[model samples]
Target: MSHYWDNLSARTNGQHTSEEFESAAYRLVVEQVIYYADRHSRATYWLIEGFERDFREALAPLGITLDVNRQLRYVYAKPQYAKAGTASVAQTLLALVLRALYDEGARLGQFTDDGEVVCDLVELEEKYRLMTGRELPGKGEFSELMRTMKRWGIAKKSDESLVQRGDSDQTLPYAVIIRPAIADILGEMALLRLAQWKELDHMPRIEDTESEDDHEVTE
Candidate 1:
């Protein structure tokens, strides 16, 4: 066995093997999070609990925090300060909107067995308009936004495997399943920033924050 394995065994008291640790770590790292309710990720989610200490230790040096929610049955890595210079302002807005939707669903007890909140395109459009005073993005941008949501573990389409199905290259994926990870990803801080969005003279740059949008938008 490798050095990490040997040490991990001793540290975890042999409750979980090195391979289990590796699997759990890989999923947490690759997916940015893991939830027990997600059928494909259920096993790894429990494994993460066993190796939580090691995960925190490994992530601490990089200024990332590993949070495990026992009630929610999920684990995710959160950076102290992150500059995600990839997703656009519109995309970020959509993500925040989805997070708000999840909150609403939670309050209303509208959740799936896996704790996901479901909504369709029309409802999303209405919420977007009500929240941001804007309609959904253009078709091309909508497609990209959906891709961003899934890539960042925010939301997923019902037909997730085929997000853009029609010949128009537009995602009419009316039905979407908002992941529970959004709560951790956006948190209350990010949502507060989003609620104050209209007051800002400048828009959120592609380089916004992770747990919070610390990058102050300026003209």
Candidate 2:
């Protein structure tokens, strides 16, 4: 991916005025940060497919490792943090999707015939657009961002043979995994927003947080 970065920058004019670039960069940052936060994680082949190999190599200084096989791709750390960082939108979306998966009790592995798996990038972004009433970063940016997540173990890809309808060339369709650590991070984010929401006049306040109560607080 490092080799392509120059071309990407040249074509996009350094992505100075591009929301797509900004979003993609944000995703990359999130993926990197989350990967460091979790010492060990792995990815499937589908998860890392769209990501650039050079990009993964750049992350090697940080103790990130990539393992690839015919049926799967894996990435993780060795109980330490890497000091490198880069800025990609694919990474951010990867984190967001993984957080959602953690909340929903799914792993960042392959989607199976008997089980639900990570959400597809297209469908996931479409949902985000619908919720926010705006278009998301382009597909290229999204792919890059997911590649970052796949590298960090925050998310993984699903095997395609389980769900694909036709005899497609692809073996696995990518999906995000929301790791336990990632879920905690996401929960913290949600908690921050919840705190912010409570500050709003329109939001319902919790009376229990204000004073002593006879019983434990309940939602």
Note each model's CA RMSD in angstroms: 6.7, 15.4
Off by over 4 Å in 2: 1-94, 105-117, 130-132, 159-173, 190-219
lDDT of 1 at 177: 86
lDDT (0-100) at residue 100 of candidate 2? 54
lDDT of 2 by residue, 1-219 (tens): 444455544664553323433333334444543232222322222223334464365446646544333232322223135433443322433355445544544534444332324565555666555433335667676566656555554555554433434566433455444334444234445423323322342443234256433322111
List the candidates' TM-scores in order: 0.73, 0.36
Best by TM-score: 1
Q: Worst ten-residue run, lDDT, model 1?
A: 210-219
Error of 1 at 57 (Å): 2.9
Q: How many residue pairs clash in each candidate at the backbone level?
A: 0, 23
Expressed as tens digits, the lDDT of each residue in 58-81 for candidate 1 is: 667677788888876788877777
